[model samples]
Target: MSETQNFIILGGSGAGLGVAHSFLKHIEPELRKLGKKYHLYIIDSSSHFFWNTGSPRSVVSAALLPAEKLFAPIADGFKSYDSSLYTVIHGTAVSWDVGGRTVTVELANDQNTQTTLPYYALVLATGTRTPSPATSLHGDHTITKAAIEDLNKKFASAVSVIVSGGGPTGVEVAGEAGHFLNGSAGWFSSRPSNPKAKVTLVTNRDKLLPVLSKPRALTAEIYLNQVGVDVVYNVSVVSSTTDADGKTTVHLSNGEQWTADVYIPAWGITPNSSYAPADLKNDQGYIKTNHATLRAEAAGPRVYVAGDVGDYSRGGFHNLYATIPVIVANIKRDLLEAATSSDGSDSQPNEPDRLFTPNNSETQAVPIGPRGVGAVNGWGLPSFLIWLVKGRDYMIRNVSATVNGNMV
Candidate 1:
């Protein structure tokens, strides 16, 4: 096989795994039949992978699979392959050179030794970074052990807690905090208490779960209220300060202030594009891609993008269900030298052509305490069942199984 067909994948999170799985499921068979040899290199900084969506539950129940359980050793998972066919490196990519087709990665322990891995094709699946205050205020920011420890300490002493932001992450944190304070009747004999630890969920939006429909939003509000969370709507925080007494004073834009023992900032996320190749990125620092094809719009053939870093009109929630299939098909076609055309297209397309088109099936599900509100394909389903399926279990088992290659 030519060196140009070899693949180097950056970021081994959901997106990275998705692309790798796609290649294995769709493209591997064709390559094996043709007796073609292709190298696949997977790189990530961390050895552990946590199910981020399940983090709220981790904070509340303190029940989480160990870091090793949540992730498969990258080397072990690919050990069967020849060294030339597949390799997994534990390092952080400092930057990429588009013109040279090289990626510079710094080893975890040996920061001084930087290695450049030249690739025929590159997949930029490095997801977004968590927001500033959230990432800065706490260590192990990516919903890992260290982050849960920080929250646990606050929960132990907090009399009142303030959760800023009304988005899915904020809502989940607020609801989970309430559950931690109130305790579970079925699971525990006594409820946990910080006595003064009241949870106040502050949202600038007029309603909770603004992305969901009115009915679902109302359902989430009801659930939160029932769990003893103080819902403050249409209020924005102007400034926050820590008093001499070690309490946090949050000044609201609506001319109100509240004191809390702990405050959690669950604001939105921004893409982490600083380490990526500049030429492959758009003005927003997100990778510019043919939404249909999932290939870099500027880079030539073989390179592809998936998950959060890729600019897709369908938004975050839908990208999981939509982009994976297209990426798989494209990779397979590229391996077989098949025509790079859509299913019904008459002519093969050039590099950087749109391979997939998105539909307006974007949906979001927010878990409020033990109940949840969801919009399926823009259709509202205000039910407590959504929470039962997602909120209660946090999908930890499913994620663990996937990382273990069980296909659960």
Candidate 2:
């Protein structure tokens, strides 16, 4: 019998889940042809995978749609595969011994108990950690969904809403809140028509969606303005305090002050690479990778990385979509080479691992309410297409379909 190699993937979101599903549905068949056996273990602290790209809108519309739609069980994606071939561990990866090819994970059910996993290869797709509603990293979908639902209740009654950050998340939040108040008749009936009832967006940059093309940025600003969202540019939130009345006062770097009943900070995310070797990380703590191969720079060739945790020039769903295929290909190549080698011997250098060549460029789609705007490969997209593609339901329906086994 061939020795069964172990492949451990640490993450259950976009990149990690993408590779795992593709491997089971596509690559595993090829490996079976080579008469190689392996156990693929996917570990994540959360039992369910949160579709964070749609989180902004989901949080705002929690009352209209079921919170369950925002999360999908990680194990559900692997149901079609053989039980012995793949296992999903519900735990947080705390530490790793790269030299020994062992990883320590903190089990979600029992925090005090830890489990060590030995692997022939490891794929790091832990992604990033961000504030709730922007990216839920609570490791529990129920808690995250409940928190967002409570926040939506707060938003429903709030006279004023302030969202800090001009990036995609903030823009989406502002747009969704504004649209909910202006468009939702049932939600609007409760609140009095005070002009003060506003959705304010604060950003340090001069333009909304600064990383996007100028045309796209302008389009986004126009959409937000049309939806009654106040875009406050060139200002940063210095501090915030809540008063007895429950209204919070936000102090800005420009010496401006604003009071709002609801406040959300969508500033950014921190890369979830605490287990990564210091030498493999950049100043911002993102794992440095060989972009061509998606391999960790300082880690051995057996280790790879993808998604937001990777030190790619840009991090987004489109980038992840383009990157995961490369990661899967490289992992398959390495596995095939290992399978061809004789017992206890490394394969000759005749066949090298395939390099990941990215065919797609940086692409972003920022949905604002029923309208949308974005750029793909330096080309701007029309509002109708953006609306049809993402703004309609913020891709929630698509994610829900995948969870229902329709698109998976």
Which one is best on TM-score? 2
**Model 2 ranges with Cα > 4 A deviation:** 184-196, 241-246, 343-354, 357-362, 400-408
Put down candidate 1 lDDT per residue, 80-160, tens digits, no spaces. Answer: 445566677777888888878788988866889898988766788777765522232121224356655656666666769
Q: Could you give candidate 2's per-residue lDDT for residues 1-408 as a string of tens digits?
A: 477878899998777887887777777777788888778999998898887767787677666555677788888867777898999999989998878879999999999999998888888999887765435666677777877776777777877899999999999988888877765223344322443358889999988886687767877887787667878889999988978876789999988898898888888788888877787799999988888888884777578897889887377666667787678877777777777777642343355656665535536788887778887887877878988898776678666444433443
Which lDDT values do the candidates have, in the order given? 0.66, 0.78
Model 1's TM-score against the true structure: 0.83
TM-scores, all models, native as reference: 0.83, 0.90
Say which candidate scores most in lDDT: 2
Please report how far candidate 1 places residue 379 from its true position, in Å. 3.9
In model 2, the worst 10-residue window by lDDT is: 184-193
Q: How many backbone clashes does candidate 2 have?
A: 0
